[model samples]
Target: MEINDLTPAEQQVWRAFATGAAVDFREEDDEDTAEGAQWGPERTVRATVLRALLLNGPQEPGEIAAVKLAGARITGVLDVRYGTSDFAIRLSHCHFDEVPLLYGARFRQLNLSNSVLPGLTAATLRVEGVLRLTDCRIRGPVRLGGAHIAGAIFMDRAELSAPDETVLELNHVTIGDDLWAPGLRAEGEVRLNGAEVAGSIRLNDARLDRPGRVVLDAETLTVHGDVLMRKVRTRGWIGLRGAHIGGCLELSYARLSNPGDAALRASSSSIGELWLRKGPPMEGDLNLRRAQIEVLVLEPEMLPTRVFLSDLAYTSLTPHVPAEHRLPMLERDGDGYVPYAYEQLATSYRRVGDDHAARMVQLAKQRRLRTTRAWYGRLWGYVQDATVGYGFRPLRAAVWLLSLLAIGSIAYALHHPHPLKASEAPHFNPVFYTLDLLLPVISFGQEEAFAPDGWYQYLAYALIITGWILATTVVTGVTRTVSRQ
Candidate 1:
């Protein structure tokens, strides 16, 4: 690290580090900032010299001291593990021969924008300011697990590729500000599991292509602000299971396709709001089982072929439509006949003052329950549904009562039954007699005083049985309705 051993570019960078002057090494016509024509020894700087300059840079009295170099070919590994630096490091439009090792290092800010590197291993790295990787192309994985950043991390327009391995790993990372990575193209998995971000996670317009695998696994990640992934196109799974978001989780216009499996799994997550509208029908399953959201903004047509919505609760639904229209979405639940999902939908409808639609959802829930019941139970359910729609359609009960009354009156009026005793018998009234026959509990003494012959007796027996069944079913339906309320 002697002054005499410094290369031409290194000598310029070393002298300029005290005053925080940026050393540009690019030709005038070089348009490609990342990897232009190869620079000779004149533009090459040893990583050891850069590391030494960063750690032991002379402080200027009134000027900021920083290492700012551009378009240089860094020769060796920039190993600054466990090192502490008071100055910032900005290496733009450069190429690194080896991955920079910044493990457990502390810095004010780190900017590697428009640089082409093999990889980066900065686990447990502590940065007081922003970490910029904008427009860079990384050929290998970038690991930042357990890192603490006071400022935001920007990876806008960056292309990270690791093929079958993870491209970006941010597990257990704590960010004081946002992690902005819009227009990112990652060829492998991007994990953010157990990461806690004080600000939002913006990955809008990103393309994540890891076919038949997990493209993004952000399980148990906690975000204080929104996690905006609008228009993100992913070829594999994007999981956010058990994640807690303080603000909205917007996935509007996203196209996620992972056939025969869950394309987006947000089960057990809690979010302020979830916007999944303005997208095409997803190619795979959308699992939101047990997720809690304040507001759910979804387009019904955007639902995938299969969905798992058991116990998923949302206080409000956008587009404020009838529950009947939303009921079809519940029907697509992978776990068939989830009563909680139906109840949640019904509650959402009721919140919107759509009581009729809420009742319809409840009715649908009952019908779905029938499918899971025993044969006898289903038969009884059919009876209730046919008579009164399980208390949801009270008009059906009135219609049934009127129809039965007419049939009974017509049958008895055709032929009067003989009286058991002449003294006890009243005048022959068909309507009163039919009423007595239909009303199993309250009788007008007609059924007790008279006895019918042959077919007439059988008809009377049938009426009595039908009357008792209708009474029992009506009571049951009414009890169910009252208990739910």
Candidate 2:
């Protein structure tokens, strides 16, 4: 474990490892406070540099290559700008502390993998070697393009920070191994365009912050591995415009808050969404285009909150679009996803005074399935509603009043307890006035009040009122239930 304990050959490899990773040949915009590394804070910045050479950077390859040397401590900047030494540097659980990298710093043929790399700064990097920072922090923008990393790369918990510039470019880099950057945090935009990962590329729980427009045009990029990004947070819209992914594109519980486009785009790619939340850059083919969520999709509204189907073809308005747009959504997705997407698109178009575009969706639906029931059902429901609205309860009161008068007339004729009173001085016939008229309203009350000779009109009056209430309740309940349904 001591720095000077390693043999002389191991010493050179350690020195080369330190030297190759230190000094840069290019100029950058941001000045760093990164100091040349040492073993520990107790050791001076000078002694640790020399001691690093003995542990892993051997002087001769014949000695270190022929034998196995392990547990190396590397200090200081190893400016390996095309350094000739091809050291394997394969040791698990080694510590990489405060190593300042060179500009255009290439990890070509060098392996400082499966180790702890904290407080590291590399501006422009080229991953030409098998790099493993499974739990490391390579803080800063990692612009590595056209660099062929020929071995498995592990960056599980790496933090990649970018310089303060308009764009942070990390495009077209090829990885020979599985590239993992799950839980990776980048202060600026992280671009991975034309990148090929031989193994799976996992980037779940990754955070990328870019104040301006950031493009991840990993189009034409091939990843032979399953692309995993679940619960990831990106401060900008993710662009995978024309990217070709060989395996499933997994994104679950991801939050994308870019003012421009969707948080993520697999538009031209085929993939999966076990649990996805895709909002947008106006309109693009999100995960809904390819896969289905085995679970649910959360908060699916984005930027403009609509997708336009200007490219859809139909029997009516959408007839202008190509037939491709009118086709069913991909087989594996949820049933209503595409229709909803189109629905959203139509809404957006309508807001901008595009009536024709709005009708395009309706026409497309008709072409897909012909049915008049929807329209008729609406009309039928409206008619029932009108019936209830137009019918007046006060009209029934008028009919009741007429019936009361008829009953009064009949009562006067039938009640002959007194003989013809026209000649009998109208015989104080007060019953003919109030009693007769009021009798019809209370048929039952009249019967109980007195014999046919008495004011039996009260019975009919009570019966009429009971009938009215019964009729009203029956009619009201029926109409109300129908309207609600």
Candidate 3:
């Protein structure tokens, strides 16, 4: 394109680039600094730089380095859709009246650091090099859906606001390297659903505030490296449901404040490790239903009262959390008890060499099952709990037996039953008589010798029945322990 063919605004930008007099916005502190800097006749480069670059091929390296359109007010849409370019477009410290549309555009690199834009719509855009927007302030939503970046997306210290809806959408995007956005402040949801990142997604020290809504929705996202969000403060939920993270998902020191709903939902997601320890107490449920995590580093006290852990499997739990602290976290669905929830907890306890804790978890499972059982089953479950602690506390059976013996002996002594054959009987001892009545298989000849009529006879029968129940419970508990070992 000739200089005469260029529009007036385009010619101004072309002259700036050709003469190497283009203002470097990066060196200037802000838009005011760029406006104050004297650059020949024009203080501001009022041109669509994207159009100028497409019309005239890639500029020289030295010229491109100094080709910053600082304090420029771009008039029309900078549409680079379906076009191919080999230039590193740097538009720092510029003010855009409209957002740069890069839909389906291919670029070598794109840098808009420290710029102020209405928003960005770069759906299906492909970049061969880094896409830097660090420290930029975007007032509207940023749509990067279906983008394929061979390098990182740097938005460190950026302030983005798109209230109520998604502020930054990176759905189905592929990033070769890290998405570095530390210290970012986003007012609305940041959706990364179905995105694939070869490196970590570092949002450390970022503040995502969308109360009562999802602040970070990364469902089905695949990250080869970690998702480091250490010290992040989110007012709403963080959904990582179905995400496959090769490395740890570290949310340490995070402050999440959505009490009515799940603050973190990672259901069916597979991750190497999950670190939630040393954080502010979570205000809402941390739903990890069916998530397969290798290692879970969480402090018991840091978790909220309501945590959905159904089918949530983990090989290790850090900080040595006791089963007592973890059992309450497996919330029941209505009145129905989740047996696998207890099983998972028991497995966790067993992994930590807490056999006693494992047994306690089993006891809790049986207790919960009792609540959902029929009347007869519930009665039997209660009996098992009281007699032997649902086969967990075998010593309880002995305690019950001793108490029954003492009561029976006291009753027999107080009644003072006469012997059937007073002269022929060997002795009339209440202790022996109670023992004879209590022992089902062993006959001490005291029951036949004694003649307890009316209420005492019925009491004797009750003692016999009690003895059988205790004996059966103790035997069943012993068998169960042996089988478990």
TM-score of 1: 0.95
Candidate 1 Cα outliers beyond 4 Å, as residue runs: 28-30, 34-37
What is the lDDT for 369 in model 2?
31
TM-score of each: 0.95, 0.47, 0.86
Candidate 2 colliding pairs, count: 53
Residue lDDT tens for model 3, 34-82: 2333432233443455565554644565455225465555656887778
Best by lDDT: 1
Residue 209, candidate 2: C-alpha displacement in angstroms: 2.0
Q: Looking at model 2, which ten-residue stretch has the lowest summed lDDT?
A: 310-319
lDDT string, candidate 1, 1-485, tens digits: 67888877788999999999989987763557555337688889889998998889776799999999888899889999999998989999888988999999999999999999999999999999999999999999999999999999999999999979989999999999999999999999999999999999999999999988999999999999999999999999999999999999999999999998989999999999999989999989999989999999998879987899988888998878767668889888889888888888888888878889989999999999999999999999999899889888878867877888898788878888999998878887777787788777887888888888989899889878888877877788789889978
Candidate 1, lDDT over the whole model: 0.90
| lDDT-superior candidate, 1 or 2 | 1
Candidate 2 C-alpha lDDT tens digits along 1-485: 35576445344434445433332211232322133133333322232443233233434444433112223344445444332334443433333444544345444444443344443433345555676656444544444455566776666766555446423344666677888777776676566777778888788887767744553446566777577877776666677655656565655555566553454554544333223445233333333344222222233333234332222222112112332343333211233334444554455445556655555553344333322347765554343233332122234444654565566545654663343333533333334443433434433222333333445545445544544543453366456335523
lDDT of 1 at 237: 96
List candidate 3 stretches off by more than 4 Å.
1-22, 25-41, 46-50, 58-71, 331-336, 406-436, 442-456
In model 3, the clashing pairs are: none
lDDT of every predicted structure (CA atoms): 0.90, 0.46, 0.81
